[model samples]
Target: MSTKTGADAEMDAGGTETMTVREAIRSALREEMEDDEDVFVMGEDVGEFGGVFEVTAGLMDDFGEERIRDTPISEAGFVGAGVGAAATGSRPVVEVMFSDFLGVASEQIINQMAKMRYMFGGKTEMPVTVRTTEGGGMGAASQHSGTIHTWFAHFPGLKAVAPGTPAAAKGLLKSAIRSDDPVFFFEDKMIYEQEGEVPVGEDFTVPIGSAHVEREGEDVTVVATQRLVGESLSTAEALDGEVSVEVIDARSLYPLDTETIVESLEKTGRLVVADESPISYGVHAEIAARAVEEAFFSLDAPIERVGVPDTHVPFSPTLEEEVLPGEEDIQAAIRRIY
Candidate 1:
């Protein structure tokens, strides 16, 4: 596995290329669209505007309006349309501008998209991929900055993935697009420009339900998702010889890699579950619960959780910085656990 914290590694002559998380995601979409005719993208201002985050930039010129279609500013309508399209036959990749806006489309996402296959017993398929930007920073304010991925991760029938590195972003997204199930791909807006080595191949895909041990050590195991993954990695590097920290990126939130985390805990005997979501019954809670359930004997300290203190993300920049969890938070958690 690639170490999470490192200098910007240039593209080797081999199969991997250095790319930002945004570029990697765009590449994944382009490759997937080229491979499958059924795959199409639709969202507000996605075609001409290149999406709110510009992750879909230059796709329309390659695939034309039919494949890279733009939709009305109605999350419920377009999201429901994507679900319908998926049910019929097409593999639709629908982008919701902000994950915070997903609440407006919750009916389509939770009830219809998530349950259609199961509701139909074993006959139907919901090959819909919902891509949305998440997390604080960029001062998107309370509504747009909330890390609400825990809702979908906890909800039944939806596969949730939040990529930490560029490689994870590309691979997990390809996997999500190719999967027959509905997958919620949460992209942390703050990490779009973060660079990493990404495998360059059409067949390159990171399987859903897998966790990568980004860094290996013997003391505390820090299992983090999305933005926190990098933060935790940096914290681990800072600690260095002082504390042996094992950093694991919880890439797939729903089908979480509990075994990987459990194995790390078995060796390290301490854990810190960190994510940008709220601390109250969020991703941290779930990871902590799993560790307690499976690795009780390995526990040397109470599991520490680093996340927002059960509050909505603040609009003010100072308050946002204060409320959002980061490398310092991970460091503090590791210290506590150690």
Candidate 2:
């Protein structure tokens, strides 16, 4: 990771600076590729069409087709190729297009890329980054929108990271590219245009297994991931004098920062996990389990989980909003906990 002073100096130039979350991600990839000859991006429509969401826009002209190669709609084939490339000393960033499409390449991800290091007795490294978008709000339907980070986190030897802001996205993506293990990077489709203060320039990396404290309070602790962090923050503000809610963004789900969460619970003695996934066997369950194991003595009441109903994500806007967790749901959970 680069020093804060250096990052600030790079951002001080100030020349038409605002960028969206998607644009910041594109910039991170561009900087990493320019710095390291071994780093290359390969995925569907990444070369000619600039990716499905325009996240990889105009990379083919800059780095040429070789580094920014496009491929058929074969998730299994290309994902396996990426895993092979990583083992052979090349850094490959594979975009799975949509999180729902990951099922087509699950074997390559779970068995091959994830188990390579252990299967080889730590003789080889798999430095592959699988980037994909998930969650609702774009009317992407059930197949295109789903928060399945918990599934990847359940697997060993792989890391899962979901950034809630543009700055975190850029830094974390850079870190993922340089990692020696496979990573599942989940991006929220709704936050594509969401903007934040990202320090410009190169060599900026946010380490994995760390959580960010978005808001400080004393009554209750709300742990959230991805765009849910934004919703948690809004709910915190709305509670105002009624409740002192602290928001903790669990940026990395796999190597979770349980220490931060436990410490926050020590002060607040109440917890609420706000996740945008199904309630049953989801990330919130893991978090609640950990809190119980580590912070049971500190907790004043039963831990609460704010998440979607245990049903498939609906396509209708009204039904989807009801099914998914929102600010009001979080607020209600906070009231219960506090």
Candidate 3:
């Protein structure tokens, strides 16, 4: 609940320290690695090589090669191993490098990691955490960039968390690590270097199913996820006098904080769902569906959805930027609803 709109509050931040999203995630992993003997990190280059994004840079040196295992390039092999390890009592945090590569291991994710607990008649717990990077910045092309979280969110058994700020990245990652069910933690590769205040203690964690109102206002409600959270906040700031926007960060996609959104819709009467996933049959559609279902009478305007068009992330920088929703896109969506 450390949610606020204007510049992240540094006042009275007792145990909070400033760090980048990447560093915050690494710190969470380190604390979990130290606190739990069963918690181990495994993935390509996570050991001596220190991960493609270097999120696991210094972990191998401190925890040794055994705990920070470097697996082969096979996503299915290591991912399936992590699923088996989680069911057998070990808490495995497996990195898939890029979320696009998750398709190579979809069978393990969709079939085993997601369904093990229910399929085993509630007798088993799949405490597996799959960490992957998403988004279209840095010119990574079609293969490396994608917002495929909606697929996992649509699945019944898996939990999904995507954080937009350093504090959120730390808090949500810790909670995901501790959860008994399988969790997919998606990190926007573009925001790795973005810095913010993060709680210093290992015990600090944001509740999994709660949403944070980053900016409180009386006009419209803009519910966004991942990178779009920050973008929508910026948009709100730019339109300060004309449009009073209330920004809500939908941190957890699955087990979404429907109550928070419904309440916001009641207050503002206008909602714009901003997700990086494609526009058709995606996260935006779900959020809109929720608003219509729960608070249809309170709405003063139609619900708007800001997202990429139905297509793969383009290789051209210009094309990618064009398709990806930006602050302008969010503002336009709000104006449409206004």
| Candidate 1 deviant stretches above 4 angstroms | 1-14
Lowest lDDT sum, 10 consecutive residues, model 3, at 4-13
CA error at residue 101 for candidate 2, angstroms: 1.2
> How well is each residue in 74-185 modelled by candidate 1, as lDDT tens digits?
9999999999999999999999999989999999988998888898995999999999998998887998898999999978889999989998999899999999999999
- What pairs collide in candidate 3? 4-214, 5-214
**TM-score, structure 1 vs. true:** 0.96
Which candidate should be chosen as best, given lDDT against the real structure?
1
Model 3 shows how many backbone clashes?
Answer: 2
Please report how far candidate 2 places residue 74 from its true position, in Å. Answer: 0.7
| Every model's TM-score | 0.96, 0.94, 0.96
The better-scoring model by lDDT among 1 and 3 is 1
**Of 2 and 3, the candidate ranking higher by lDDT:** 3
Q: Which stretches of candidate 2 lie over 4 Å from their true place?
A: 1-18
Q: Enumerate clash totals for all models, in the order shown.
A: 0, 0, 2
- The runs of at least 3 residues in candidate 3 whose Cα sits more than 4 Å from the true structure, single-residue gaps closed, are 1-13
Indicate the worst ten consecutive residues by lDDT in candidate 1. Answer: 3-12
Candidates in descending lDDT order: 1, 3, 2
Kindly list the per-residue Cα lDDT of model 2 for residues 1-338, writing each as its tens digit.
12233223445554225677898899989999999989999999999999999999999999999999999999999999999999999999999898998999989988899899999999999999999989987776899878888889999999999988777788789989999999899998888988877776675566788777778999999999888889999999998898898998888898998998998999999999998889999899999999999999999998999988888788898888778788889898888767
Model 2 Cα shift for residue 261 (angstroms): 0.6
